[model samples]
Target: MSSSFFGDLRVVLRGARFRRLFGTRLVSQFSDGVYQAGLAGFVFFNPEQHTSAGAVAAAFAVLLLPFSVVAPFAGVLIDRWPRRQVLLFSSLVKAVLGVVTAVLVAQGAGPAFFVAALLVLSVNRFFLSGLSAGLPYVVPRDQLMMANAVTPTCGTAASSLGTGVGLAIGMIGGEDALGTGIILFVAALGFAAAALVSLSLRYRELGPHLEEEPEEVRAAVRNVLRGMLSGLRHIGDRVPARDGLLTMGVHRVLFGVATLMTLLLYNNTFTGGGVAGLAGFSVSAALLAIGFFAGAVATPWATARMSASTWIASLLATAAVALVVFGLPFSPVLFPIAGFVLGFVSQAVKVTVDTLVQRHVDDAFRGRVFSVYDVLFNATFVLGAALAAVFVPPSGVSAAVVVAMVLVYAALAVGWTVRARRLSATCKGRGALWA
Candidate 1:
């Protein structure tokens, strides 16, 4: 909202290194959006498909839960490899996988279709961690927070725009196998574009320097066994970073359930299970996109005025209140408003946590910690969808789920307030830590 905030964006984008890196992220995430939109259309929005809560839960678990298990390995390698190379090869792999996935979708949105898509999505997580891990190298520490604020938000906005593109493609493709396949093929092209963009960054330009690389293959194996623990220890007892992880992981669990309910409600209950359902859900997605950008715009100014803990606590509490206010009656018109509010809150919290980790964790362990971050993020979301399967009805109207999320948000907010006050009372670095 302020001229100075716009000034900061200009400042961060001014560098060639940052520009190349930023361009890579934007292009890759746009592909992510396009890919996801195609999947959603084939799996959920297709009239021939009969979607259930159990099916949704199983789909997410199959796609994400395995990825969560193997993610640490990717993290360890990311720390060992040149990040730019990781970006390049991962993009190349994902592009090929994207084509494979498109072919499977054309056959039918079958078991293999999900599995192929999972491979692409898993590589996406690895690529994203490398981006985050390498970010500190491109921007000054002083500007890292602003960089986090800008990059993820813009990336998400690109994803949202890509979703719009996917939707338009889906229209031409007509929500069938052939249509979804065409959309996915377009997404694959986007990945190829990302690979080309990544070439602009020199090898090892974003990295764990040569001295830090493991000496041998056996050492790499040993590193994998111990590296996760090292990353966890590195984050230990630093209240802001640790609690930030906990809050975000929990938030995703609750939000994931909410997302399931929204999808089911729009498709089965609100819009009557056709193209209309997807069109309605797109409204929520669009609102969320706007909210993400709003959060990025608001965070720097908000954090500058108050401690990160206070700001994050206020956001969690606001989500609780917003869920109650807008989700109570489960009105079709109101859920999108709730989506916008929670989207803003979610992105703001993420930006804060990213800054917390970037500022607090050592560079050597950043990839691992962020790997841990991704595991928690994805795992909890699956847990939420699983919980939804058990509790939320197919109709997606569940007062119980609404009540549960509010309580969790309220509890997390209280915990944040108490714990932060205690930590600030004793921490020597509290001034820097909380800021």
Candidate 2:
């Protein structure tokens, strides 16, 4: 079974288009991981030069804000433009920004450089959103779950490896200036590689433009505005898609809350122990990455054993349990264990939800549907982080807020799943529009 699973993964990897995209993503994700580490280190070590941690966090918030706000339009663009060209343009812009950031930082331009870096990061995120929105066009619907699982698994692996290497380089470089240069150089290389690979891809038209007619444009605008309403209406109108989105939404919210909690704990609570704290945090992250990889490897078997909805619900419940476990004042050993479990379950949910969305949504509107989902997920996370920052002081309050948020989210998810199941049954009996 393992051999067969790997064989299937190999086939996906070997596909010409997937290979190019995957190859680009592999390098880009690695650099992204390294850049993240370097960014944190840069802030921590040189807070006076750049900005406060709070400011940095706000920048991250800004970077992600566009995904929720502009994603519908971005999705439309993805569907309208040649995906390869979109990717190429995005990557080239990112590379240029990276070089500009490196130059500004090296010149000791202070907070301005940091602001510029944040802007560039925001741009890079937009491109990533586009790539994610366009993914359905590259792979067949049937294989989407596996593809989703594999891409993130690969990305997590790269993150783990890249983080460790970046840390080592940062330590060796011995100064913020030197470290920033090295890190930015790597980011530039990654973006360059992504641009080159994107250029190599053979462009193919997926379908009709999302807004070919003025009436269609107006309708698309209305549809996007009514997306949440449309989603709710569709839930009443279509059972499978409704159930899938509900399950996926619950999973995303839980994962987001739990992740925020863990990161806050690591950054704040575990600070005093110095190298020990750092080592513990790194180990916890590595374990989480491994968990994601394991979950992806097992996705095919898990799918074979249960329906996607069942898999999704089970994963959400498992993640809820993990969050509770993490929140408890337990031994340090339990922290990593909880983190690993959360990571594994979250990866399972991601794969299942992505698969369900791809299968259930109309092919023409797949990008928009996924974009809507992405917007919800991103918005919730930003809200969670903002609330945590606002309500939770720099001390114990932050941790407490994070824990409480996770528990609340978990309860909501449980309720949602129950309601979704009941709705599914009722739709079946009434011969309603759900299924």
Give the top-scoring candidate (TM-score).
1
For residues 22-62, write the lDDT of model 1, one tens digit per residue. 99999999999999999888777777666789988888888
lDDT scores of the candidates, listed in order? 0.87, 0.62
Q: Give RMSD to native, each candidate.
A: 2.4, 4.6
lDDT by residue for model 2 (1-435), tens? 222446657757766767777776777677677766666555533433323235434654765666577766655555456667777787888788777777776676577766767666655655665556556666775566667778767877886777887778767765557666677667777778778877666665333344554554435435545543444344356556656666555555545445544544555565442344455667878888878887777776777554555455566666666757665653456777877886787677666666656666654455556566667667766765555445544432244654664665467567646755765665554222222
TM per model? 0.95, 0.81
lDDT of 1: 0.87
Name the top lDDT candidate: 1
Off by over 4 Å in 2: 1-5, 44-59, 205-260, 273-280, 391-393, 396-406, 409-413, 416-435
- Stretches of model 1 off by over 4 angstroms after superposition: 1-5, 210-222, 423-435
lDDT of 1 at 267: 86
